[model samples]
Target: MIGRIMKIVSRQYTLLGENGEKHDAILMGKVRRQDVPAAGDLAEAEYVNGRWVIQKILPRRNRLIRPSCANIDQALIVMSVKDPDFSPALVDRISMLIMKADITPVLIITKCDLGIPDETEEMIREYENGPMKVIRTAKDEASDEVAAILEGKISVLTGQSGAGKSTLLNTLEPSFHLATQEISKALGRGKHTTRHNELHSVAGGLVADTPGFSSLDFSHVSASELGSCVPDFIPYLGKCRFNDCIHQNEPGCAVKEAVESGSVPQRRYRNYLGVLEIIQNRKEKYL
Candidate 1:
């Protein structure tokens, strides 16, 4: 029988069967050695000798490298606007990974009730007009619009802990009762509450609450490929004087001029530089 893996906890796979039955499964020898199944994988399981063992993993449409998951239609990059504060660096970093995997990235801004700072508002506006669609959520309100967009799609909600990923999931599907915690005052961040990747049925679709993107491993992305990942940079990319311009300090760089001319938001450019440095530094360590 074929089923979709809902979540795997401590090597125990819990899958949703064809008739909506939940079964606990484990990977068989060949499947375990060849392909490691992720949360969103459609797998073939066999009830041989009274054990539901996953025999094979189906091909994936797209795979998110961070918070590792597969076959995702869209990724809701949840970030808080006020409490834990918004980090454009992390947002842009995750966006690059999602785009590289060919998954639609949606910026879901949480915690608007605490109010938005002028600077953050400006940055949000940049993303509002960027490649990915931006959606803001208040602590207390209906998520019907967000829910409508999630309908019939395999979506994942990921961000910093206390960014309200679990809260938003509960709001969209009241029965989830996902545990949430307050932001730690000392650290100025959220508590890591969601421990594992689990896909729950929500808004007539499957939405997985990943264990945040705190350790968003972006080491695999190359600096040269970074420009193409940022959709906004496309128009000014090849126009640079240097054919290998990474858009920083290169003479006659079109992207730099665009930032100066107000074509690209300064905040995004700043964040872009930060991620670019990270990728370059990671490359340096290998060499």
Candidate 2:
């Protein structure tokens, strides 16, 4: 029989069977010898001698390395307007990672009640005009739009530590009772409350709450492949003067021209250059 893994605690895996029954299963020796199944994995399981054993893990559609979740349909890139301050670069990086995994990226802006900076608001506007869907929510008000977007999609919620990812999750499902902590005034960040990635049924879909971090590294991404990760640059990619243009100081680069003409957000372009530099440096170090 095949079942979806709901939770993985140590050696035990809680699987949701096809018949709506929950089964506590253990990995078979052969399966254990290979790769271990993540929480969102679908596996072949058997019930023998009153014990359920997972024999094999099926193929995954997409996987996130940081949160360690598999088969995600979309990524909710949460960002705060004030507290830790919004970072467009972080959003760009995470969105790129999500796109690389072939998952849709959705930008969720939190803390709107605190008032968003003019520059940040402008940035949000630019992202809305881009590829991904953007949603803004506040602590005082419920976001029906956000709830509607989550419906029927397998989403992974992730962002900076103090960005209120857990708080937003609780607001979406009041009965969730997910533990949330106050932002440390001295550190300008919230305490890490989500220790592991676990999927919960919410808004007619499975949502995974993941550990938060302030920064992300693109060590796995190569400089040559970095341009494709930026969704906004797709339109002007082939229009560049050079067929193999990386869009950095290259003459007649359509992307650079777009930035100059204000067609592309300057902030996003700057962040793209910054990320490209990092990827290039990593590539050089390996060589």
Candidate 3:
């Protein structure tokens, strides 16, 4: 039987069969040594001696490194306007990873009632018109647009700790009642709230509320490939005078030109540079 892994806990997997039937299965020892199954993974399982064991994980369309999950249709890059504060660098980093994996990235800004800073507001306007779509909503007001987008799709929530990933889900569906925590004032960040990645049924779609990311892994991406991953840089990509342009300090770079002409938001461009540096540093460290 092929079933979707709803959740894994204590080395036991709760799988939802293709026909909506549920099964409690264990991973085959050989498969576990080779590869482990993720929350959203569809695996080949079998009932032998009255025990279901997952034999293998099917090929994944995409996978996220942090809060690891597989085969995502879209990722909700949730960020807050206040409290933990809106983070463009973090948002850009997450979006790039999602885009590189060939998954659609949607920006969901929460905590609007806290008020958007002038800089944050500018960033919002750019992202709204930028490559990915942005959905603005308060911590209290759930978005119908988001609800509509969720239907029949597999979506995952990724953002900072206090950005209200679980809170947004709770607002969308009162019954989820997912755990949420307050931002730590002394540390000036959100405390870890979500422990494990679990899929929930909402709006006829499966949504996974994975642990929020304070740090990201850029190991799967390369420096030269980074520019192409930025959605804002796509149109001006191949138009650069030099075919090898990474859009940073390169002569006759169309992307940098677009940044100067305001075709791309300056803030987003800066964030891109910041991530590019990070990726380059990581590569250098390894070499």
* Candidate topping TM-score: 2
Report the lDDT tens digits of candidate 2 across residue range 149-236. Answer: 8887778888887688888888888889776775334445445667676788787777888853234767777766778788888888
- Candidate 3 local lDDT, 63-146, one digit each (tens): 765667788899899988888888788888888887887888899999999878898898788888887889998857878998
Give the Å shift of residue 212 in candidate 2: 5.2
The most accurate candidate by lDDT is 3
- Backbone clash count, each prediction separately: 0, 0, 0
Q: Please write out the lDDT profile of model 1 over residues 6-60, one tens digit for every residue.
A: 8888779998887879999988888888977788899999898988999899998
Sequence-dependent TM-score of model 1: 0.87
- What does each candidate score in C-alpha RMSD? 3.2, 2.7, 2.8
| Candidate number with the higher TM-score (2 or 3) | 2
Q: Estimate the TM-score of every prediction.
A: 0.87, 0.91, 0.90
Q: Candidate 1 at 206: error in angstroms? A: 1.3
Q: Model 3 — which ten-residue stretch has the worst lDDT? A: 182-191
